[model samples]
Target: MSRIPDLPGVISSDEIVASAEHLAGLQTDSGMIPWWPGGHCDAWNHVESAMALDVAGLHREAERAYEWLADIQRPDGSWHNYYLPDGDRDMAVEDDKVDTNVVAYIATGVWHHWKCTSDRSFVDNLWPTVERALDHVLSLRKDDGLVLWAVEADGTRRWDYALLTGSSSIQHALRCGAAVGLATGSPRPDWVDAADRMCSLIANEPLAFQPKTRWAMDWYYPVLTGAIEGEAAKIRLADGWPTFSMEGLGIRCVSDEPWITASETAEASLAYASIGEFATATDLLRWTRSHRCPDGSYLTGLVYPDKVVFPEGETSSYTAAAVVLAADAIAGASPGSDLFVRSSLRPS
Candidate 1:
């Protein structure tokens, strides 16, 4: 039987499967999972959805989603920031940008799928794609080891600053990439070294990246990515709790905003679980139920005082995906469950 995450009283295996089904229902015929029925797709969130599908035992659908990425990958191994459901570039101002974190995420998805299935042939097939993607990401790293946030569609002009959340995510991807390399007998020590440097920067040099302290992702991503762990991870979450968390309603998207997003809450839960704080993680995850829809989809955000959906009828595949991933992390039933919890995937 395919392993499915079951979080006991918090969430049943069947409910998690239903959530994946809801997300899968939003996927295009070409295997592209959009934010919603008519929404745009981004490489990062698309990979996130694919990971969730794997967690729910939707292996065929998950593999198909990865194939969609392989089909659309740009020559430079990066994808545009956004694509329409029909597989055309969105071409909006920032939509055409190539985000390093976005490109690096394929390694995470591929590594997670490999863990879920132990499919060495599948890893071999996708190895080149992950290699090219991370290679392109490493090429963009600055002298300080932090990567630039993004580049123009031409892949020539680049952003001057890096983002804490984005770079932290890239670090996690690098570790996942190294794990994939090791499994395929292609051992990428360089990728592992780069990931360690990035982790050091994230742990000690907060000023290395652009300050988006107001954003919930910036507050939790270091822990979520395992860039910060042990007592340090606990301290970080506690420090940000008052600012970003909203008691029973989930966490705010931005520190000052009354709007709470399910995605952020779910991911923060994973961060807590990574540090052995399962009770706290479960509480944060239980809060996400406030935004859950009847059909197993999650609302993007709910504005407090009114409890209105901020995007106005928005339920994103990524938000639901986050919930699935968090449940898996807590349940510890899938092979990929430790992908986020572990500080490193490298062989000891």
Candidate 2:
């Protein structure tokens, strides 16, 4: 099995391995990966960390992470927004909100693992989990074809809004879910239809989703998720270039914010690669190295101009995972690398 390879004159392979190890070390005995020690964990970020482990050739640890997810998944196939490492409440007010995108991302993660290891048995084992999660997510789809952002703790749905970034992510997850279905000979035409409709809204009708113009993720997620493509994807990136990108630094988390985030920068790099702009992508990934810590983990983001660490000066497993995944995509080191670059999720 191929692992993350070295990017000559850029980041070293040893550094990539160390970053993966850093993420793995963050995994608790329950196989959950918190943002940092004593930090809370979320489903989406946990899967991101697991994918990084797979990219680093730590299949055993990665599988254990997935098993953790499967073991703890709610009966409805959704996970709460926050969890403590020790499975205890760290905060007084627990967030019981269930995010549709968070639930849907297991499909992407499971499919990614199968791609990396070519493990059919593993895919088969995970198929039911993927199906149930997607079912929950797709159930949140509105008549306008966009999935609701979240289900509130009161059991009321956030039907009045849909997020561009979240919906874009769910579209990718739906396709991956459908692909998993097809691979297992249990095709889900419903998921395909939902994904196609969601893609149409994202590509043509920008107003369909809630206005989050300030966030960089909103600008690039359609491209990153393969919903926007060709000249349109290029134009999207070009349109938002000045607002989100920082030359020789990294992409900002929000347009009006001076915080440069490693995860957003790394994700933007993948979006660039999706549009065949490898040079631009490579530079973005190279720039993220500045956020790396001595222990090989990556900080969440840096407040610009002052160059100070923001958000409590913490390093995140997801941020380190994003860097590792971006490096893999740029180096073409794994089959899973093409997940971002290609439109494999597009409905046939």
Candidate 3:
């Protein structure tokens, strides 16, 4: 099977490589993948970009990106919310908090790389990091099984309320972490149970999470993370479609805005595909072509009506990563293609 993803007329393997290369180019020598040239690097998006590199057959670069994470991981297995290219905590944004979802995402990235390469040694090496990270995240899980969004840098201050988007993502990561553990001969049944609880909370206890109804991520992430699936997932998408999607454009960053974001649209495509709605998924992936830049990097978002690029010429590595992942989900081009769609509770 092809390691690289393609969408025929929509996007070619070469175009996917170009986008992956664009993300690789943005990587600092230390292997940290920032959002943009000088933008902050969040753990979640940084891992996402690394996964994209692996999807495009850039395994060496992807490994380096993971090494960056290993190098900077805190003692408690958590990473600060944002980092600079120079490898320092970014206190300027969100006061350098440690987001539970951000810390948990390393498991997803590491698992994706393992699926692409089948490298047991790599998974073995990273297993401890993944273990610690997920353990740290689960340590903060509330009685309802939903994790709080973030904690202070010192792990002293807490955010108190849970978030639907972040907790949903954590649910996915926990399962991925369990998968990684099983691969390394170290199964984590507790993590698996935690994931199931989080999934239940996400699927049944909407009020448990802080209200982020305006954000597009809040609308699609549960489905994207596989916390809600089957007919329920389809119905959720249909219910949110009118509010989040823009015909012939892309999904909005916020329901109340006309601004269309590439990453959000790409992720929504993956969510739709996970539920067997390939036609809707393919169309969503196609819509992201509008954000494609000449250099294969994706513009962050576009303001509708006039279709002006917002953030003034911003092209983010994470945006390109999302597009690459979405294409993989739709095309089933690689072993890792089903990473988002497959059940993380089982072996890949």
On TM-score, the candidate that comes out on top is 3
Point out the worst 10-residue segment of candidate 1 by lDDT: 85-94
| Model 2: per-residue Cα lDDT at residue 224 | 88
Instruction: List, residue by residue over 24-91, the lDDT tens digit for candidate 2.
Output: 88888778888898788888999999998998899989998888888878788888888876643232
RMSD per prediction, one decimal? 2.9, 3.0, 2.8
Q: Write the number of the candidate with greater lDDT, choosing between 1 and 2.
A: 1
The parts of candidate 2 lying over 4 Å away from their true place are 87-93, 343-348
- The C-alpha stretches of model 3 lying farther than 4 A from their native spots are 87-95, 343-348
Q: Residue-wise lDDT of candidate 1 within 1-348, one digit each (tens)? A: 357887767788888999999988987778888899978889899999999999998888998888888877889898888888654433232378899999999999999999899988888989999999999999998999889999998977568888999988998899899999999999999998998999999999988988899999998899888888778988999999999988888889998889999999999999888887788889999999878888999999999989988899889999999999999888787888888875242123
Which tens-of-lDDT digit does each residue in 1-348 have in candidate 3?
Answer: 556787887789999999999999988888888899977888899999998998899999999889888877889999888877653432234347889999999999999998999999988989889999999998887777778888898787558989999988898898888899888999999998988988888888888989999999999999998899888988999999999999979899999989999999999999988887778888999999999988899999999899899988888889999999999888888788888776332223
Q: Tell me model 1's lDDT, rounded to 2 decimals.
A: 0.88
Top-down lDDT ranking: 1, 3, 2
lDDT (C-alpha, whole model) for all candidates: 0.88, 0.86, 0.88
Runs in model 1 with CA error above 4 Å? Answer: 87-94, 343-348
- TM-score against truth, every candidate: 0.95, 0.95, 0.95
